[model samples]
Each structure stands twice: as C-alpha cells, then as structure tokens.
Target: MRTRATVAAVSGALALSALAVPAAQADDSAASYPDVAKVREATSVRAEGEPYALNVSFSNVKIAKAVKVGTTGRVSTAVTYTLTHGTDVNIKAADFVTDAFIYRGSDLRPDHRLFGDKPAKCTATSATTADCKGTIEVYPAAHELLNTDAGTWRAAAEATAFNGQDPAGETFDISKVGYKTQANRGTTLVQRASKLTVDASPEPVKKGKPITVTGKLSRANWDRGTYNGYVEQPVKLQFRKKDGDTYTTLKTVKTNATGNLKTTVTATEDGYFRFTFAGTTTTPAATPAGDYVDVR
Candidate 1:
C-alpha cells in the first residue's frame, strides 16, 4: 500500500507557526487558520488470501471558512486493496463499497452518518483476472461540527466479497483509521469578509420583504471546482428574526455549477438576521449574525 503525505504534517506546521506569533501579530497574519485538526487518522486493513486487505489515506483535511456557512470542508482519501490469491475471484464493484461513519464519542454505536458509496476500482490486470486495486473518495457530511461538543470522530472501512463467499477472512486493525483525539478551535474563518448584503425593494417590508441574496463562494488556496461540490444540489435559505428562537424557511434556490447563487427570500422582521444554506451532498453554510439588516 502506498502512503501519501499526512494532513497533520502539512497543517501542523502552519498551526505551530500561527501560535508562535504574538496574539496581535497573529491576528494580522495572512496565514490561513486551521479550523479542524487532522485528529482522526486511519490506515487501510490488509487481509490475506480470500479476504483482501484495503488501505485508505486522507489528505487536505481542514475546516470551512465563515463564508462557508452551512457547508463543511472535507479531506480526500484514496483506498487501495491488494489481492494475493490469483484464484479467479469475481467481485462486483458495489460489493467492495466503502463508507465513512462518524461517532460523537468513543463508542461505535449511535454513530453519526457521514458519507457512503461504492469504492472506485483501478485494475492493473484484466477485469476478472489476477490482482486488483480499488479506490474511493470519502467526505464527511457534517464537517462543520468536527471540533465541537459533538466529540471526536473515528472512521472505519469494511469491505466484502461480491457474494457471501468467505474462503479466508482476515481483518487488520489500523491506528490512523480508528479512534483518536480531536481538536476544536471553533469555526475557522476560511474567507475574510464583513457581511452578506441582500437587496430588496418596497422600502420596509411590512408583511414580508421580497429580497435576493447574491454572492460568489471563493477560497484563496482551494480552487472553485472543489467549492462547487457543496452547492451543486438544491439549497434553502433559512431565516430568523432578531432574538427569535426558531428559524423559518424563506426560499429555496439551486447553485449553478460554479458555486454561485442568487436566492430569493421574504423577510419577516426588522432586525438582525442570519442565513442558513442547506444542500444535499454538503453540509449547510450559514452567514454570521448582522449580515442582514431589515427596516420594518
């Protein structure tokens, strides 16, 4: 199994440097702050004979910026498996599916759902002959909650044969993949900005203010393509009045492939406001309070 560079080594250096500087100096520094640490690490399980060993590695894991409200950034990992026995083995792609399950605590039960799908296969030999290696990319759904009260999370990978064929089964446990301590420095701002402004007509909205929220999602180091994945699905803008207990759904909109949206909403109050954007494949991103101002 091939091992790529670990995220901790890369981000850790940045974090240490950020911590070494004076508080005031650090505040002025342009270095990007890491919202989540690469705490949970896992190595792929290697199996012998019938049961193949699969190894997975993750990279570029970090926290989403404040502008990334309702959305969470993720790390990409590659899963590799080696088949020892040359004996003809017919394995369906789906059978080798790999899933990522997150837990709030050390206990595995009541695991919080993250992401799941079939592993991507890269075969060097013929489709049905000899040895094969499969790979897949897994992203955490609730990446925004990584370093919060939700506790540390551990990831486990399970692979099975096409059918129930159990010629020989072996499971190798890995430290990097299992359970580990997590750090929560609170929400790390990936993008620097003041507020999100919404333009609407009709002076003050008495009953409801019809407005549009327009903005472009951008990242300094990350490319636009990576950010677009979060906004590809249908999204809803959730709103609430100042000092309100619960939020109400204002309007729904879909982000184009470029991660841009001009969502429409009906303002309900004349006070501080926030916007919660929800999507299917990605976690929801929210605007900071005071981002919206209402005059009613």
Candidate 2:
C-alpha cells in the first residue's frame, strides 16, 4: 500500500509542511505518510497520480546507529545526508522542502513508516550540492510496530517544491508541483528495548555447597511504558571466574509464566553470574552487569 503527501506545516529545519491523514487513521501506517501512487480526481499530474521525478539524489545517508524505541513516548533518531541536485534546482527556494525517513518492508511503497515530527533543514555547500539533517520519530504503538517489524528497516527520502504554487489553493494542480523520492539509500536496525537482571543468593557459601541463581527477562511494552515479563523465553545462566576473562554458560533456563528464571549451581570458585537473552526479531539481545558471589 502507498501513502500521499499532504500539507501541514510543522517545526524543524524542514519546517514547511507535513503529511496529513484522517485523524481516525493516525495509527494506520498506509494512511500516514507519503510513499506511492497518490493523487485524486484533480489535475493532469493528479491524472497520472505519480509524483514527477525531480532532479535530485541522496548520498552518504546515515541514520542513527541505535534506534532503541520504548513504550509510551516517541523515539527520535537523527538523520544526516548529502543531497545533490541540478543547478536549475533551487534548493534554497522558499518552498523547497526535503527530508528523510525510515520504513519497514521490502519496497518504497511503505505499509508502515516512521517520520520526523519536524522537517529537515538543508545547507547549501554549492549551487548543486547540500548537506541535510533531520530526525525520524517512532511511536511504537501508534504506528502499529510488531515484534516482526524489528531488526532492520529501509531508509528513504522525499522532496517537494511548490514552485510558487499553493498546494492548498482551489486552482492547485499537483502536476505543476515538483516532487522526487529516493529509496533504499541505506538500512538501519529498529530494535526494541530489552532488560535482563540476575541475582545469585547465598553469596558466601561453602566451596562444595549449592548456590541458587535467579533472574528476570523483560522487554519494552510500547503500549504500556513498562518492561513486562517475557514469558517462556530461554535465558542463559553464565558465570565468569573473578580471575577469568570470559563467561561460560553454566546452564540454560526458560522463563516462568512471569518471566522469572531460577536454577541451582554448585559453588566451586569465586565468580560473577549473569543472565543473557539472545533476543527475538523485535527485541535486541540483553546482557546486564553480573552479580558477584564468594565461595568459601
């Protein structure tokens, strides 16, 4: 499914306009941002319903290294890129607007997308070259991000020039507007926040006695702003000797109905213990600090 670009001025360097959709469809991905085949019964440009390609290209596009989105609030990642355009194209024009965003799926026709609440601002290094920067904000629950939607997402951008024409004008012609889009400029991970905790009881135990290790595995709940238990997930119980540099997996334990992990190990040497979760498609791996124990 594709989306249409609409006019609603927001904040930021690209603070010109935003894509407006029906209020009732705020969380509907296909109805939110611009991607493809957007036009209505209006002008000739609207006739083709395809945005005419403008003379512009995006290069050296870089998205934030970590996109760890949580529940409750918006997660914004900074985006920086280079934009090259023909000399005839006036990027400094009052109505010239361009920005980059991220989408999930295999194509530019996005079914789900994350857009900056503000527009990107650009600085011209030359008449034909410019540096651009912006942000893409993700509201996990609002955009309907699923556990399957994590891992990697494609990067893309769009530009629009009103060309002295009012998009909201009664006589407006989308055909007269200049537009361009670049897809697959690069890719970035869209990972959910995960948390793991560990605790070993009877820290000072006899060398040959039993020690109990326990932990909890949890991940971000985008709808509730909480790190809820990740039930029935497998978590590794790892131990590292105080004199050793590496941690060895002592055993693998599955989380209980409430994401709690517990297991027994025989005390042999003084060491630290921790829990590790390999993670799922929607969540990133978690390895928290270890809890130290003493063996008498």
Best by TM-score: 2
Cα lDDT tens digits for candidate 2, 204-255: 8899899999888888875555678889988899999999999999889999
- Give the Cα lDDT of each candidate: 0.33, 0.70
Model 2: per-residue Cα lDDT at residue 37: 19
Alpha-carbon lDDT of model 1:
0.33
Off by over 4 Å in 1: 1-209, 216-231, 266-268, 279-290
Which lDDT tens digits does candidate 1 get at residues 82-140?
Answer: 33222343333222222222323333332232222223233334443323232222232
Q: Give residue 47's error in model 1 in angstroms.
A: 15
Name the 10 consecutive residues with the lowest summed lDDT in model 2.
4-13
Single out the weakest 10-residue window by summed lDDT for candidate 1.
Answer: 35-44
Off by over 4 Å in 2: 1-51, 106-108, 141-144, 223-226, 231-234, 242-246, 256-258
C-alpha RMSD for every candidate: 18.5, 7.4
